[model samples]
Target: MISRASLRFSLGRFTTAEEIDAAAAKLVAVVTHLRQNAPAFEFD
Candidate 1:
């Protein structure tokens, strides 16, 4: 079976859409790097 994992993020204050998108982009980049460097790691 395959299990999915995720991260929970909370901001102390309100944030703009651009800020949220930037954060998500960073997370995707990190995940992509891990997928490239680590054979067993994968994310969607």
Candidate 2:
């Protein structure tokens, strides 16, 4: 049976382990990019 709830509310029913891993990898890449490109903060 197919579920009608959205991904965030699927109770992990419609989500796969590979999908979670891919999402985590994407998040890490985004954070890494931001860290590498963002400027350092200066305090007066």
Candidate No. with top lDDT: 1
- Stretches of candidate 2 off by over 4 Å are 1-11, 42-44
Backbone collisions counted per model: 0, 0
Model 1 Cα lDDT, one tens digit per residue, 2-34:
344688888766788989899999989998776
**Model 2 — which ten-residue stretch has the worst lDDT?**
2-11
Highest TM-score: which candidate? Answer: 2
Write the residue-wise lDDT of candidate 2 on 1-44 in tens digits.
32122234233678888987888799779877866665555111
Model 1 residue 6 lDDT?
A: 83
